[model samples]
Target: MILIANSEAWPGFSKSIECLRRGERAVDALVAGICEVEREAKVRSVGYGGWPNMLGRMEFDAGVMDGATRQVGAVGAVPDTLPVAALAREVMRRLPHVMLTGDGARRFATELGFPIDETLHPDSKRVWWERLQKELSPEALAAFPDIPLAPLSHAITDPERVRDNTVFLGRDSAGDLASVTSTSGWAWKYPGRLGDSPIPGAGYYADSRFGAAACTHTGEMTMRCGTARTIVLALRLGHSLRQAVDLAVEELKDLRDGFIGGVVIHAIDADQTHRVVSLNCEEPIHYWFWQEGMNEPEKRAAERV
Candidate 1:
């Protein structure tokens, strides 16, 4: 058994491993793990505590993949819902679709009797507003919600670029692999921005025969390169876990234009070999890792490539 996840998943690291031990499928166990993070208000980058968009509204994105069948489901730009990761899993289980967005996703949530959470934590909203007030010009601030966001889009992103979105991957004793990505997305983003978190083969991909992979931060570049899928394909073609991750990072380096930022990848291969690597990241990245015999997951720095 093996589990690899970003630091944001620290709150629920043991829950995931225990789920695997309880005889849950990889996908189910991972979903359970991430749901813990989503429920946390202090995290501030996922679920209830997620930062609001420019309009001061909270929207979330989530994706889940089942490696055995390569079946996937994702929801993007959703609002008034907590833990959309579970909804994504349900989409994979119940619907014929691979992705759902906006009202469609909300309607599905309603069908499932999910409660609405439009009232985001006041601190998250206040911080978003304060930052926007500081960044926007007097005229832009005067225009406010009535203003066209496109003109101010360039000024509204989170200045720190702190992407704490959750990406969790696990390999069970049954040789099953699964991946899940859940995020509030880029802080102060345009209302409908859908990052790679909800896009399969970009933010996440899994195939039990080969391995599973997921990404965090810098979703735009990952979407363009299909980073997660590319890593799994490398493993399928007989590359070691390290080699596969190296190739993915090389692909990121090849990009000369478009949104370029740091990316941290978490992956586990069929033989339970796991790796975490960062690309173009200014700061060192750390992730959690655990195998069957370990009493607790280890926190270690990612290899910066």
Candidate 2:
């Protein structure tokens, strides 16, 4: 068994590895792992105390894929819920729809026994206030980064300096593959905006016949290119894992000179081989990796190209 996740998922590494060791399905292990991170109230990028939208309301997004069965589920723009990834799994098992959003998502989750509340974490609220003071324009009561002076104008300054998302993929002992992605979307983003995390074939994809791939960072570019699915399809076409991921990164280069904010990929092939790639990101993108032969999960870093 093998599992790989971005650094934000480090808190859940041991638990996820335990699931894999017990011969759990890859999908189960993936969700179990991400739930740990989601439950953490201190992480500003996902769940609980995560950063809020520009309107100072917390919203969440999550997605999951079961490669063995080709079943998928997703939820976006959900408010006041932390275990969205698990809710997504429930969606895969029960709901007829592939995605749900906003109050509708909250209602569905509540009907299905997920938590619901209108309270915001104190820290998250504080951060939202700080952002308002720094980024909001009193004249318009809108974030400076979101204003438009004219059609097709480049007047709006980008507020996002860096973005983070948690994406994980696993191959179980039985060779079944699965993936999950979760995030609070871009910090101080427009209310009701959904990023690649909740979009199938954009931020994540899994197919037991080929492999699984998950993406993080600058969700817009990934959404536009359907990068996660592209990587897996490249593997289906006989490209090496490294080659496929590299090519996917190449597609995002036009965003800004040769960078697209930041991008990272975690991938595994049917043969159990794994690869990680980063674009315009910090060097040595950290991730947790564990396989059958390892004594314990290792905190490894993948060099960005």
TM-score of the candidate numbered 2?
0.90
The sequence of per-residue lDDT tens digits that candidate 2 reaches over residues 1-305 is: 88899888976778888999999998999899898898787665777647776666788899999999889999999987888899888888998989989888889888988767553678767866765565446864454545542321222222434367798899898889999988887776667878899898899999999999998887878987889999999999999888888888877774554225778888999988998877778545888888898998888887677
Q: Which candidate tops TM-score?
A: 1
Q: Would you list the clashing residue pairs of candidate 1?
A: none
Residues 1-305, model 1: lDDT tens digits: 88889988877788999999888998999999999999888777888878888898888999999999999999999888887999999899999999999889999999999888763778887787888788778997898988888766676667457665899999887889999999998887888999999999999999999999999998999999999999999998999999999999999899999878898888998999888888888888899998898987899999878
Q: Which stretches of candidate 1 lie over 4 Å from their true place?
A: none
Shift of residue 287 alpha carbon in model 1, Å: 0.4
The deviation in Å at residue 302 for candidate 2 is 1.5
Show where candidate 2 strays beyond 4 Å. Answer: 117-119, 136-162, 254-259
Clashing pairs in 2: none
lDDT per model, in order? Answer: 0.89, 0.82
